[model samples]
Target: MMKRYTLMVAGPLVLLGCAGPLTPRDTQQAIRQEVAQAAQPQPAPHAMTDAQAQAALLPPLKLELPKGAAEPAEPRFDLAVNGAPAQDVFMAIVSGTRYSMLVHPEVAGTISANLRNVTVPEAMSAIRELYGYDYTMDGKRIVVRPLTPQTRIFKVNYLAGARVGSSDTRVISGSVSASGTGGASGTTGSGSSQTSLETSKINTTLNSDFWGELKVALETIVGESGKVILSPQSGVVVVRTTPRTMRDVEHFLKATASAVERQVMLEAKILEVQLNDGYQTGINWSVLHNGQHKYSSGANTGNFDLLTGAVSGSLADALGSGLPAAAGTTSGIFGLAFQTKSFAALINFLETQGSVHVLSSPRIAALNNQQAVLKVGTDDFFVTNVSTTSNTGGAGTTTTPSVTLQPFFSGIALDITPQIDEKGRITLHIRPSVSVVTEKIKNIDAGQAGKLTLPLASSAVSETDSVVQVEDGRIVAIGGMMKQSFDDSANRVPGLGRVPLLGYFFGNTSQSSKKSELVILIKPTVIDSQADWQADAEATQARLDKLERQPQTP
Candidate 1:
C-alpha cells in the first residue's frame, strides 16, 4: 500500500465581519467603557506578555531574525507609563516557533506602573497589527484574541523608540509557538532558541532584494547545504540543518538549477509561440514533410500503372510511411499499392536533374490562408467518311477515288475559377470549349477554320457535355462534331461534257460530301468578392484587447 499525505493550510485569522458601524457617540462610549475596565489593577500572567498571546495563535514555523540579539541604544516605538512621565522605555525582540513578536515598553518606576497606564485600545491595535488578530479588555486585563480560528505563521522584526533615561530598558519582547497540531516538533522547546545567526542575516537581506540577489543567495545556500530537497509539487525548496559533503551539495544545487532553467525556458517558448500563432503551429516537421515528392516520368507507351507504383514507392521511403498513401496505380480491374516512398525517390532524382522543383514546404503553412487557380486547356472533335461510284457505256469504264479526314487530337479547354471564404474555404468554377480537327481534304482550301457539322443522330453531342462542375469551384466540359458526304450524279460517255481522252465513251459524273467538326475551349475565373480581411483584422485586435484586460496570476 502507498502512503498518502495531504497538507491542509489554514487561512488568515482576520475576521471579515466587525461590530456594526459605530456612530460618534457609540465610539466614545466604547472607548470610555474600555478605559474604565483597564483602570482596575490586575496581576500579570506568570512571565507571559501580550506578544506571547499573539504568537500563540500562529503556525509552528520558526521565523528567521536579525543577527546579534542585543538591544539598540535607542528605541523607535512610542512608550507611556501610568498616563504620565513617558520617559523610561526599553526595546525587546521576541521570537517563537513559527512566529516573531516585537514590543517596546515604556518604563515606569515599577512594572505595575507600566501595566496600569497602558490603554487597552492601543494595546489591541498594536497586537492586531503585529499578529493579524483582534483583542478586547475585561476588567483590569486586556484579552488578546484571534479574529478567527485560522492562523498563518508570519515572521516580523521592527525597531522601537527608546526611553529618555533608562539604559537597562527592554526595547522589544515577543514569543511564538505552534498554533495547530503541535505534535513532536512543538515539544522541542529550544528549537526556537537555537536560531542560526547566519540564517537570520540571510533572511534580512532576502526581504530587501527578493527578486535580485536573493536568487544568487539561494543558489549559493543550496550548493552549500546538501540536505536541501526541491519539491516539484509544492514549488519550493526544503532545507535540512544536517551537514553534508561539498560534492553532494554541489550536485544537488546543479540539479535544482537545471530544473529551474528548463522550466523557465519551456514556459517562455510556449508564451512566444502562442502570441504569434496557435498551438498547432508548433508541430514537428517530420509530420508535415512526410510523403512529399518532386517529379516523375516514364516512356509514353510504358504502363501508366507501373510508373505510378514506382513513383509512389520512392515518395514513401523519402518522406516515411507513417501516413496512409494518397495516390495509387490501377490495372483494368485491379490496383496496386503505390506508396509515397517510390514517388519521393523519383522526385529527388528529378530535382537533382533540374527537371522539377519540389518545395517540401509545410502544407499547413502554404495552404492555411491561401488561394490558387488551375486551368485545363481546350479540346477538338472531328469525323469524316467517303465513297465513289462510276458508269460504263459501249466500252468498259471504271473510276477509283478516296477521301479521308484524320483526327490529330481531341480535347476540351477547362478553366477553373477559385474563391476563398473568411474561414479559408475554397470554391471552384470551370468552363469548357469544343474539340478541333486539322487534316488534308481532297477539295478544301487551306488557311481556313473549317466548319463541319455531322448529322445530329451520328454525333456525340449534348447540352450536358458542354460543362463540368467541381466541388471546390473547379469545372470541365466537352464540345461536339460530325461529318458526312455523298455522290450526286453519274452517266455514260454519250454526253459532250466528257471529252475523248478524259471520258471513255463520254461519261459524266458529280459527287457531294458533308463534314463536321467540334471545337472546345476552357476558361477559369476566381472571385474574392465576399472576403473581408478588414473585418478579420478588427476582430483580431478586439481579441488582443480583451486578453490585455484580463487579470494575471502567479
Candidate 2:
C-alpha cells in the first residue's frame, strides 16, 4: 500500500485567471453582427457612456467630496459561487466625486443560469453570499446601506423581461445612485446600471420607418395650403396650422416631423425690390377793365367824353404794348383796351410782373348765354400770382386822389416730371367764375367823387393737377390779393388797426364768408394735365401736321 491518502475539496471556488484572448477575425465578426443588429433599429439610440449618462441626467453639474482629494481603487463585486464561464456581470463604483463602471459577461451569465428558477429572496441571498452586500427597494428607489456610517441613496428604475411563452424567457435590471451631499456640491453619483439575459428571440419594430411614414403625410398636406414666415438669422421654421386649431397641430405632426421644413421652402420664393417718381402743373388768371359812366356833371370837372377818351387811349396803349404776345393768344384778344386810366395802370403792373398770363385772352369765352371753353396749357406756361389796382383823379381839382385797388394772389404748381419720370406728374387746371358788386357812398366833398368798389368781391376758380392726384377736385371761391396796403391812418382807426402794418399780405383772409373753399374729387387713375388735356391733344395734332409737311425718305 503506497500511503493511499486522498484530500476532499469544499463548496464552490473561482480560480482567478486571465480572460481568453479573442482573435482578430473573431472580433471583426462580432463587431459586424453588433452593427447589423443595431442598424435594424428600434428607438433612437442612446449614444453616451454610463458616466456621461449620469452627468447629463443629473439636475446640476457639480459634485462634493471629502476635504482631501483621494482616489480609490476600482470596486470588485462577486456575482456567483459556481457561475458559468460565459456569464455577464455589471459593476458600478462611486469614489468621492467620480463614478465609473465595469462589465463582465462571464460572471453575469453564471449568476443568471444558477438563479433561473430562484425566488426573489433566494436571489438576494445569493448576491449577499458573493458580495457581502444587501439591497432593498423603496418605491422606485433602491436603498443600499453599507456597513460604514456613511449612508448613500440611489434612485433606480427597473424593467423585468416579459414572459413570451412556456419555452422562452428573458430578464433585465437597471439602477442609479447618489451619495454624500445634496445639490450642486453633492458627492459622486452613478447612473442606472442595466443587465439583461434572454433565452427567446426578440422581434423589434424600427421607429425610423414609422417617422418616415409620418414625414410623407406632412409634406402632402403642407403642399396644398400653408404659409410660413422664417427668420433669416436662425434656420428655425415656426409651424402654424390651418385655421390655427388643435386639429391642425395633430395634422401637422402626423404629416411632417417639424414645421421648420415648410418655412424654409416658403422663404426661398419671395420677391424683394421699390418703384415711386413725376411732375405737377397749375394755372391762374385776373381781369381788369373800366365800366362806362352813368352821367356827366360840369365842364370845369371835365366832360364825360374827354375823361372817357383819355381812359380808352391809356387802356389801348397798355393792353396792346404792356401785355405779352403769349397773353394775347391765350386770351383770344387782339388787345384789351379799357376806357379808364386806372385800369391801364393796373394792367401795366400785372403784365410787367408776368401775372397777366390768362387776362382777357382769346381763350376766354364771350360773356354770352352760350358757354365758352378756355383751354389752358402747361407746356411752356404756368401762372403763380395775379393782382390789379385802379386810381381815379378827383373831380376837376385834386383834394386827395380817390383810389380803388384789387390784388389776386396764388401758388404756382411747377412741373416735376423731369425729376421723377416713372410715375405720372401733377398738373393744375383752373376755371374761374366771376361776380362783381359795386356800391357808391354819398357825402362827397366839392372836389371828390363818392365811390366804393371791391373788384374781386366773389370769384369761383377750379384748379386740377395730375401731380396732386386729386380728381374732379376744384378749388372754388379763390380770391385774395397777392399784395395789400394799409394807410398810416389805419392805426388811428380801431377796426382797421393791426391789418398787416406793412408790405404784402400773401395769405387768405380769415373771414369765413370771404375765404376760399375747395371741393376735391379724386379719380381712380391720374391724368397728365387737366388744364392742358385738350391743348395737348391740339398740340399733338399740330406736331403731326408739321411732321407730315416734312419730306419723307424715298
Candidate 3:
C-alpha cells in the first residue's frame, strides 16, 4: 500500500514537469526579456597600437570639396567625463579609431564633456572650438598644439601687375578769329591774338595696385610680431600670425577675391532709324514703354522724359549724358533707358518707328574694373596736312609739296569699362563713336590764277562719352544722332536727256530731304561662374549654326 502511494505522488510530479502549449502572455514575457538584454551597454572598443592604427588608416585624400557639400558619415561614440585632462580626453576620443594622437606637454587644461552619439572628428572639433585648443592631422597621426603663432599659406589669384587709368572730358563754346598784317619796307608791324574758353571739364582716374595694397593691409593687421610674405607672381601669400588675426586676414582676402574676380559680358547694337516723315522728332520711346510694344521689364521710368519731349538742363546735360549736342534739343534723346532680357523684342519695337538698319553688332567681355574695346571698320589713310618747301640747289630752285597722311577710322567703335558692386549694380564708362566718309569739295589758294583743288577726306562723326549706372541685363539706349541728306532726281527720255541746254525743258526734277537717327543700345550681363561663360559660348555657337544654315546670297 505504501509503495503504491509513493508511485502515485511521483506520477503527479512527473505530469507537472511535462511541457504544454505556450500562451500569448508567456511569449510576450520572453520577448520583453530578450529586448532588455539587447538594450544593455556594449563593450568598449579596443584601443589600437601605433603600428596597427597606421596600417589600418587610409592615406589622406587631397580633393576639392564641392560647394555646399554635406558632411560625410563617420563612426560615432559616447563620452561622459568630468574634469578630465584635455590630452586624456583627446586620446580617448581617438582611441580604437584609425588615428593615433600626440598631445603637447603644455596641453594641461581640464575638459568636461557629456556627449553621446558623436563622431571622433566632431568631438575633437567641439573641444578645440570651446577650449581654444588647436590641432592638426597627418595621415594617421593627430598633433594637438597650444595656442601659438602658426604659419599658414594663402592663395591670391590675381595678376602680378598694376593698372592706372585716367579719362578727361572737356567742352568749349564759341570761337575767335584774328587777322594780322606784316609789312617790310624799313618798317614792320605784327599783331597776335589768342582766345580760350572751357565751359566744363570732368576728370576720372583710377589706380589699381592690388598687390601693394594687399601687402600693406596684411602688414598692418599682423603688426610687428607677425610676418607677411607676398608673392604676387605666383599668387601666393604666407603669414605667421595668431589664430584670431589669421581669421581676420582670411575674411578680408575672401571678400577681396570675390570682388575682384567678377566679370561681365558687354553686348552692343548700334542701329539707324529712317523716320517716315511723320515721326520726325526721334524714336518714340513712349511707344515702346507704354504703347502696343510694351515689354515686360523691371525698369524705373520716372527718370525718363519720353512724353511731351521736355528738355532738361542745357546742351551740357546732353553732352554729359553721352549724346552729341549737335542733335539739338528738338532731336529728343533723353533718358531712354530700358531694362529687359530679350534683344529680339527691342529690335521689333524699333521697327515700329521707321526703316531700321543695323549699323553694327559688337560683343566683348571685360573683367571687373577692366577696359574692353570693340572696333569694326576700316582705318583709311587720308591726307591731313600739306606743306610747301622751297630749296635752292645747283639744279634749280624748286617747290615741293610735302603731304602727311593720317589714319581715320570710318566705322563704329565702342570703349567700355565696368565696375561691379556687391549689390549687382554695374557702373559703366561708355564711349561710343560712329564715323562715315562724306562727299564734299574743299578749295585751297595756291597764290595763283585759279586755285588748288584737292579731294580732302571729309568725315562726319557722332560720338558721346559718359558714365552711367545700370542693372545687369538692362538695355541702355542713346539716340538723337541724326543725319540729313538731299537727293535730286530727274525724269526724261534718254535721248532727250543727252541735250544739255534743252534737257531742262523736257525733263522734270524732284528734290527730297531724308533724315535718319542713330540709336545705340548696350547690355551688360554678369558672369558669376564658368558655367555662365560656357552657356554664353554655347549660345553663340547656336547662333552661328542658325546663321550658317540660311541660304547664301550672291
Candidate 4:
C-alpha cells in the first residue's frame, strides 16, 4: 500500500519535472488503479524462499545444436548430448523430429541429458528423467508437463500377450448328438441322429491384483469423476483423472515397472580396409634385480579380431610363436573410434594394427536381441546316377544304382543378417545354399545292354552356413569352401611308355592342386554417440565416392 502511494505521487513529480507529460495514457490509468488500491486495506508481500524460487525460476529447455551440421531428412536421430541448458535445446530437437513436442509452463529447469544417439522416444525418455515431468503423444505433438492431480489420461500395458482383449455380444451355439444300435442275432438294426452347435462369447476385464489396486487408488484419488478401465485382450489399463492423481500413479509406475523391465541393445561397425602400414619401432625392456635373482619384462599391445573376439597375430602372439611382430605394419581392416567409450575405443585401437577388411555396411534398424537376415551366396554341382538291372533265372528282377558326385560350378552367393541385443551381443543368421544337378543311366540284365539317359528332376540343395551368437566388438570368422580344382599332364612316347623293361624311357607327369577359402568377417560396434555413427557413415561414403570417381583401365 505504501509503494502504491509512493508510485502515485512519483508519477506526478516526474510530470512536474518534465516540460510535458512523459507518462502515456496507459501509465496514467495504471497510476489511478494504484491510487484506488492504496485506499483499500492490504497485506505486505511475503519474501520468496530458495526452493520456491527454484520452482518459479524453472525455465523451458532449448536444444544446443551442432553449429554447422545439416538437419537430418528423417525425424529419427542418433542424437547425443553431454550438458546443456533446457530453454535453448527443445526447439531444435522438435523441428526436424518426426514427432511434434511441447513443454508445459510447469515443466521448467536445466537438464543434463545423454541420448546416446537414440530415437525420438528414447530421447524423450531421457529428458523426462531430467525433471519429474511426463509426456504423452498420439499422432500429434508430444506434450511434456509436470504431472499433477488435475491432469487426466494415462495408459498401461501388460507384459506380452494379454489374457483379455475386447468385448462384444455373447454367442449361443447349438449342440449335436447321435445314437445307434446293432444286434448280432440276425435281428433288425435301428439308428437315430441329432445335430446341434452352441458357442458363447466370454466378456472379461482386468482381473489381476494390480488391476484391482489401480481401480481402488483411482477411485480414492479422483473421486466419482475419475475412471479406470482394463482391456483383457490387450492387457492395457486406461485411466482418467486429475493431474494430481496422475502424479501419484506416475510415481507408482516408476517404482514398480522397473523390476519387470528388460533392456537390450546392439552395436555394429564395418571393418575398413587398411594397407600394411610400414611402421618401424624399437623394442625396450626393463631389467629388475633383487638380492637373489634378476629378471627382465617386456610388453607390446597389438591385434584384435572383431570376427573372432580373440587377440590373434598380435605382437605378443607373434613373440610367443617365435616371430616378433613389427609395429604399425599390419594388414587388413581398421578405422576411427569417435570417443573413449567401449565400442569406439576398440575401433580406434584396432585401426592402428589389424588385418581385416570391411567390404560394406548395410543400414538397419532393429531392437535389441532381434534377428536380421542376409542372403549372400548360392552354388550348383553336378552328379551322375549309374544303374545296373539283372534278370536271374527266376521271374523277379534286381537293380543296382550308384550316384557319382562331381564338381559342376554353378554360382556363389551369400545371405546373412545379425541381431543385436541390449548387452552388445550379436546373433548372426546366415544361409548359404549349394545347388547340384544329376544325370541318370540305365543298364539292362546280362541278357542285353542298356543305354544312358537324362533323368527327370536332377537337382539337389546343400546348406553349409554356420550360425553363431557373439559378443559385440568381437570378430566372427566363417571359413568353409568345398570347391576345388586339379590338373594333371604327361608328355612322352607311347611305345616307350608301354615297354615294361624299359619303362624308364617314359614321359614325365605334372600335377597341380588348387584350393580356395570363402571367409566372411563381421565386426560390430554398439554405436554410443552420433559422432561415432556419423564417422562410420562418412568413412563408408568417402570410400564409395572415391571408388566411383576412379578411371577404368582397358
**All models: lDDT?**
0.29, 0.29, 0.74, 0.46
Per TM-score, the best of the predicted structures is: 3
The true-structure Cα RMSD of candidate 2 reads 45.9
Top candidate (lDDT): 3
Better of 1 and 4 by TM-score: 4
**Candidate 2 whole-model C-alpha lDDT, 0 to 1:** 0.29
Candidate 2 displacement at residue 488 in angstroms: 44
lDDT for residue 540 in candidate 4, whole number 0-100: 51
Per-residue CA lDDT of model 4 for 1-554, tens digit only, reads 99999999999989888866556656655654654444444433886788887878995587886698775654556554455555445655676656777877765556666555566666766666545556777775777665453433444654443232222223235557565656453333434455544243323232225555556765675577777766645656566765545666667766544422322222333343232332211111111022222211122222233234343332334444322132122222221111123434434434444343443344444333333333333334445333333433355544445555554533333344455555655555443334455554443353444444444334443323334555555544332222344789877777887677676568778897543222234445555544554565555555555664788665
**What's the TM-score of every candidate structure?**
0.16, 0.12, 0.65, 0.31
Compose the digit string of candidate 3's lDDT tens values, residues 1-554: 99999998999899878968779658756755554444444444897788878867965667876789665567788999999988888889888887789988877788998989998778888877677788877876889986678899999999899988765444556557564755453333434454656565555577889999999999999899999999989999999997667777889999999988999999989988888777776666555644534332232221223333232433334345423323233564433446576778888877887899998999998889987778888988877665554555577766666777888778988888898999998878777788887546688795854697776787787666556667888777777677788999989878986698988777888999888988888889999965676577666655655765789777
Residue 146 accuracy (lDDT) in model 3? 68
Q: Between the candidate structures 2 and 4, which one is better when assessed by TM-score?
A: 4
lDDT of 2 by residue, 1-554 (tens): 33433222211222224446789657756765554444442443766787888987885856876587566643343334354322122231122213332322222223332445443345445655555343454442334433221222111111112112111111223334432322233222222323343332322121223233433554454444543333323323343333223234345543332221211000000000010111001112223312331111110110011112221222224344433332222311111212222323433433433433332222121111112233223222222222222323344322233333443323222111101113332122222222223333333243454343332333222222111111111111121212222333211334344357532233223321111212121111222333333443454455445665789777
Rank by lDDT, highest first. 3, 4, 1, 2
Model 1: lowest-lDDT 10 consecutive positions: 263-272
> Candidate 3, 527: how far from true, in Å?
1.9
For model 3 the TM-score comes to 0.65
- In lDDT terms, how accurate is model 1? 0.29
Worst 10 residues of 4 by lDDT: 279-288
Runs of candidate 1 exceeding 4 Å displacement: 1-354, 357-386, 392-395, 410-424, 427-526, 529-554
